[model samples]
Target chain A: MRLAAIALFALAIISALGACSKPPASERFLQDPQALKRGKGLFIGTCGAYCHSTRKDNRDAPYLFDCEWRHGGSDTEIFNTISTGVSNTRMVGFAGKLPDGEDDIWKIVAFLRASREPCG
Target chain B: MEATVETAVDMGSELALPEIPTHWTNARPIGHSRGPVADADLRAGPSAGQWLLYGGNYENYRLSPLETLNPATAPTLQVAWAFPTGTSGQFEVSPVVYDGIMYASSSYNRLFALDARTGELYWRYDHALPGDLRLCCGPMNRGVGIHGDTVLMATLDAHLLALNRLSGEILWDAEIADYQAGFSATSAPFILKNMAIIGIAGGEYGVRGFFDAYDVATGKRLWRHYTVPAAGEPGVETWAGTSYENSGAPAWTSGAYDAESDTLFWTTGNPSPDWNGDDRAGDNLYSNSLLALDPQTGERKWHFQFTPHDVWDYDGNTQVFLVDIEHEGQPVKAIVQANRNGFFYILDRNTGAFLRATPYVEQLNWASIDATGRPVVNPSAVPLEEPEFRVCPGNMGGMNGAWSGALDPELGLAFIPAIESCQHLQKGISVYADGQPFLGGTPLITDAEEDTAYGHISAIDVATGEVRWRYRDHDPLGAGTLAAVGGIVISGTQDGHAIALNSATGELLWKFRVGGGVRSQPIAFELDGTAYVAIGAGNWTSMAAYQGGTTNIPEGGNLFVFKLPAGS
Candidate 1:
């Protein structure tokens, strides 16, 4: 019984250290290249094709590449906005719509951030 | 013929009228006593120097009988007058001319009554739109329909409004559908008998597409024909699960009517969740197809699917042209259409029998239609989630239904405004919301340069589906064509030029820089013994998206009227 408790303690310590070392969900997608590529595919296929545009003078929907953020600029805020869409507008929430669920959305956000220039 | 409104009230002496401009000296009197336009007049096509029907006639020929400005005299034509609508964005409205007045609708449902002879605006009516209204495309009102003294207009907020012809006052308004649910009307209402028929647009938003007929006397709906069938319906078996509820088959363009056969032929757009067809399997009926129905009862007579299980957003809503062609050595009534799927199709108008379909555009790699007119899609063209596949004609299509075609029944030629391009289609994921875009994939433009995308006006032989002649251009042709008598076919370009081509041969006759992209249909009419041609000049969202590099073409709405300068 004492030996089992020691093993449990060691496992808990290892898990804690791993959790502390891991990045946030918002930032984790940015670090991975495959995630960014997948995010780009999703971004180009979904957002760029239909509503939002890459051009600065997109008249139908909001332009994403620009610095002006209509909803929120933070990664979490963008994720939330994407997951639960803005009301009284054409932008609908895409929570369970994506194939990879939240991971796909995080990758999309990471792709968007990578494409965007740093805000002053 | 010019006259003044001399009104004497309680005063003994006659009141003086306003001084008329010198240009109005030779103009005809506004609101002459020619009687109200009857139902028979609408079916008679353009006559007596008047244009009452939206398609110029029920056959959607868009041809004018005026021969004053032929190919020989077209070069001498000068701008008679220009009326600026003062609105931004593309102006695609073809003004309805009758008696001596012209009725035109601009973007955002703004209608105007102008003196056909002079560029004087009698009145203008600006429609009140909702604040939170959702729209799939840009806010555009194609044109208006005229029945008696009431002018009919379909708005972007999903409402059909009746306005008084003289005063531009609102007569009555009827809700088409809920705008919040992504239902909107952009096509000009077609006046048939005593009913005004109009189609709804919202395939991008996954709304169940429908075409409706409203009583002209009262704003009550006569009947509604849903493009996508409901559960237990005859065509519902084509869809999987309950996907037919929001499966799009939007009849978003004007239809052609045959008085003899008593049939109304309308075309439908792409199915919803356009890219990935995994959710809804089987041949999605009615979507990307042509539907023939009873005009009065709205009962489906027959339907012909142009693209079965269409994953390529190829809308079959091009302008329907009713033509009588010699088929198999017999004169047969045929319905011809330059479809967005890069094919020029001919079908029996009496029966929904497919005669032939030939490729009208250069780049068509997705499928080849079979003997029964069903497309044999290439397996590689099927959209997948990860790897992108190349498909010709793209989403905008080889020929967009937005820009209409002109059919010259006399010459047996149909002038099609065609775009040649291919797109890399990649399947994406989509979710259905009340008013959200339901696109399940993205069609990425392959390349703007390297001649991958361009526009041309192809003169197609109606019977054989052969390309008689083609007038090529750098930019995609966005304007509708107007075929006038004297062997002249008039069309506009994206780079701000109104051009005239010989109908028999594709020879350029006259070209005028309109100072803006001419994206509207041209109408020809005669007033005071002079034939005049008019077109709307502007640019829109799709033109900007398709155009590459730098463009100097300005964007502004203006109605330009041209005529031969004082008896050539």
Candidate 2:
């Protein structure tokens, strides 16, 4: 009877997990191709165009198309950096400026991931 | 407490002549109690011991009648005072001195009203800029304009502000454009007939550039003259599809005003996607061109394009000078510009007829100007997707309009801060998004090419279209040139030298190392019969790429004022 109860409990846990929806759009930003395109537009227009250069060496700001991240490299870390900004640096928080808010920030993250190359 | 310096400086005893009056009144003080800058006062130019206009006068000559700081006294120039802005970026301000106060606008929209003679601050006003700001170049404000009791400034966030001339208090604020859509302004507002005239800067961000005149009293827009023609507009056919809407023809600098002709002469910059002109097919009307407009209505009276369908980003935004010159043995009202496209062009100010175009730089390999004022294109220099083409003047042009050049009407010569540089350019795909750089292709330079770049202060005789002489420098001469009645041309070098050359002969008479690169224009004024000259010394981001890097230069913002010793 104890073994039967354990199996039922395990089954119930699996059923609950299966019923849950997929992760939020922002969490799954890196995997979404459409989101990546939106991020490229945002990144190219804002960050890449002004402060950070998408390609080429510009001492004004870091080049965003390389794997050597200055602040943070992980998906969530970059999002946090973009939303909150690095202090004492020209990199300011774009959370308030971004029209789409969190979604746009996530899109920018996706774009950065797709374009980043292994640093020398 | 206001500190006053006692000195005796006067305009070289010229008033003793019978033609000139011994005692001249400043007429009515329009705005402020002590230092009012009236319309009549500004039109009288800087003759009254005050710098009332950005161009010294509406002619934009940048010439001062003060012979006190002539070539003789130039060598003995010693620092009388120095005012530190405490902010660092590009210190390109050319202060306006009126009554006893100096009004200077520095980087990040900081304006200071100080004792002109003592360099003691009376009041300070700093414009609040947004954290998420878009800027193509450094956040520099070239200078400020004064009229009545108000001083006018155009901010980097694309706003026209009127500050109380007496206390630096906010008088009125007018939004020029949406900064988020990539529009920003850096030029000093040109005060014309009670209107604060300003131009927008965002050629890199695909903005529809324009010059707007605002009612100084109400902060209301009087009229706006769009640089790029929109749909159904007269010049819309020059642009392919809807490209004209965002194609840049930015007027990012102040222009000269002619009270006689009642015409305002303003120049426009390059078209969008600076390096690739395939998308914008026809001659980009008014882009890289001079627009003679009616200041009252903001209507285009006449236009002369320097580089038609400019793919090289040769901006016609260089300083425009209105001079009455003897062209071909006849007195002609001429408009002259040491144009960025490697040429010094002179045209009839009234009719817009091209008189002459002369190449002012060594590496101007792109196009040669024909007799009819059109550029005879060189096919090899055109950008191609597969193979890159080497073009002269690069994207920075032979002369960048960021710094004003001086036109010595007395010498009939135009002193240009000339750059000798070139780069290989290839066409690349650029998709424009709102507030993003619309540079169709980026200018990539090799170390060898960059190392070969240098600059000079070239004096071009407007009459004969001949280069009289070039004061060459190891670094780019990025500072504006100032001419005085004493036959002296003053300019600064990127290597930190405030140099004064003989206006007629290219002779370097005096130079002072101010511990920082000098990128500002030097203005000469007199107080109590004592003559003083002022310039801002600091580094500029625009010259970084041309300089290879700015690590070697000392970086700080300070206004250095020099005057001859008590009895020099």
In lDDT terms, which candidate is top?
1
Q: Is the docking of candidate 1 incorrect, acceptable, medium or high quality?
A: incorrect
The DockQ scores of all candidates, in the order shown, are 0.19, 0.15
Cα lDDT of model 2 by residue, A7-83, tens digit? 99999999888765434355577788878877765654445423665445434657777777787787777888988
**Total backbone collisions for each predicted model:** 0, 8
Worst 10 residues of 2 chain A by lDDT: A49-58
lDDT of 1 by residue, B1-568 (tens): 2333223234444774544321112233358877777988898998748888768889998899988768888888789889987776679888899878898888877778888888887777667666566766677778999998888999989999998676665679999999878899999998999999999999887899999999988989999999988888898999989889879888789998988989998899999878877788978999988889999899989989899888888888988899999988989899999999998999998888999999999888889989999889989888776546678877787777777888888889999987776777778666666666777776655644344577899999999899999999877777899898778999898778899998989899999998877779888998888888989988765444553211455567899999877775
TM-score of chain B of 1: 0.93
Q: What local lDDT score does residue B74 receive in model 1, on the 0 to 100 scale?
A: 84
Model 1 stretches astray by more than 4 angstroms: A1-25, A28-46, A54-72, A80-107, A114-120, B1-30, B386-388, B449-451, B547-552
lDDT agreement of model 2 with the native: 0.79
lDDT of 2 at B68: 69
Per-residue lDDT tens digits for candidate 2, residues B332-372, read 99888888888888899999999999888877888888889
